[model samples]
Target: MLRFFFVLSMITTASVSTSGLAQSSSVQTAVDKNFLELETAVVEAGATPIASIDHARLAKAEGVEMPASRVLIFSDPEINTPILEENVRAGLDLPFRVLSFDQDDRPQIAYTDSQFLKVRHGLNDTQALNTFESKLLEVLNGLDAAPAPTSELFADYGVIELRSQRSVPEAVERLSTAVMGQDDTVWFGEIDFATEASQQGVALPDTVLLLFGGPAPGGVAMAGFPAIGLDAFCQKLLVYANEEGGSVVIFNDIAALAELHYGSSAEPHHGLNKRLTSTFRTAIE
Candidate 1:
């Protein structure tokens, strides 16, 4: 648990996004079966269904009826707390959900990948989060006869360590400028984590999470892979006082994160892979 934090930090104000239950485009159609069987099985699998949304009835009430669209939200404090305890923004992905609906009169159930949280929340290491996802998927698989969605996928995110020859603020300023120069859509946000700690009388070095992202690729990234929303918007730069008395700059590996979430298609959609590769070099150096 603490291992993942080395990169994401204590997870407070810097929080933004994480898409739990990464959905697969492959699950295009619903299965012709009883939704109750799935529901009961989900409970038996150890995850509680906290809420259910009947989209068809709700839409019908508005006089614009639709198919049998139902959404089930799950709650497992054991599965959710590890993420929420670190960053509250993760609540968006919480109550973890599963959607069951009549698509063309066939019933379909969907589950998202938890790894999305690791990328978006700034978790440096993903082993713990990936493990939880695997457990959740195994439980869910027991509920449905069909195969459960892919839960465990390795995303090799690269973190560049640039030994800043200047002051912390100066290095951040240069990096921010370079990120923006590459593309105006790339913007930045900064949080003074170390300053907050010093206020509590705790001795600490200068530490900050320099967050950045813009519309150029973000909108396109999500447009291609809606799931990438969790990974894209949260791109950032981490600067802290190193033991050597100088500051070290760390940032999310765009290519690694994009490929992880979008999988193979990431290379062509708006040329994300190529763009990210160039940016990594530009942003870090």
Candidate 2:
């Protein structure tokens, strides 16, 4: 039996609720703000804005019509390091994100709640989680947006895990190379959770996260529902050490994400799920 430290059942189960807490919080802005304005807001809040994806523009270039939508990825090392020190898996949600989109002709913003992250990754640092959540909320409140009720967009997001014979670093390298080799995908970058934890004077097993996306398929999915980008846009694959002297790889289940954001009738974007599974399988082998 593989002694995975994290709860495999919790991650694999479909649409699991975070004990009644909404997975995300959304608000409608009183005034319209462009993508650049939103990005500036995040930067001015003391978080380092890492990247922004203009899903609407990307879809437009592909001949798909999508409302104005964008996702901003940002992080405050001071806030993130402490939480990561408690549970390295929290890296999966770090470099926090906010999604802005046009809904009913009104500009709206949505972000994952820090409480959701604490539950999703089984984090135990109450102080750190509270601090992170407070900072994020401060940024959203500054936008002059009327807060909407929290939403449980998905019952629970699903995760796919693959056991690898190689070490964590080796598996990460293999997966990164394989993902980058595909012409349809673009490699965004990576986050080294173990290293970040170490910098905070905490010892954690090797863990790394690779961010990449297939714009063609991802854009199509966003065209259907722009809000899905809040959770599923930039695909992430996590490689982490296990107690058995090997490593494990994990990523979001595209099919589950589609059903979570879209309805059960939704299908994985253009067979992208199958291709992603195949890529990870080969990388692990």
Q: Which prediction has the highest TM-score against the true structure? A: 2
**Most accurate candidate by lDDT:** 2
Predict model 1's lDDT versus the native. 0.47
lDDT of 2 by residue, 1-285 (tens): 011111011111145366422222111222125455766777778876666766655555556665666777777767877876776666667767787776645676777777677666777788998899888886776563332123443222466778988998788878878888887676666777777667767777888877777667777766656666775658877788989878978777766655655554245453766778888999889
**1-285 per-residue lDDT for model 1 (tens digits):** 011111111211223243321121112123213345556666777876544444333333434333444444455555554554455334334445554544333455555456555654555435647666765575566454232223434332344345654556666666667766763343333455545444544444566555454444444444334334333443545666666666666554555545554454444343654564466445545
In candidate 1, residue 233 scores what lDDT? 41
lDDT of each: 0.47, 0.66
Measured against the true structure, the TM-scores of the candidates, in listed sequence, are 0.43, 0.79
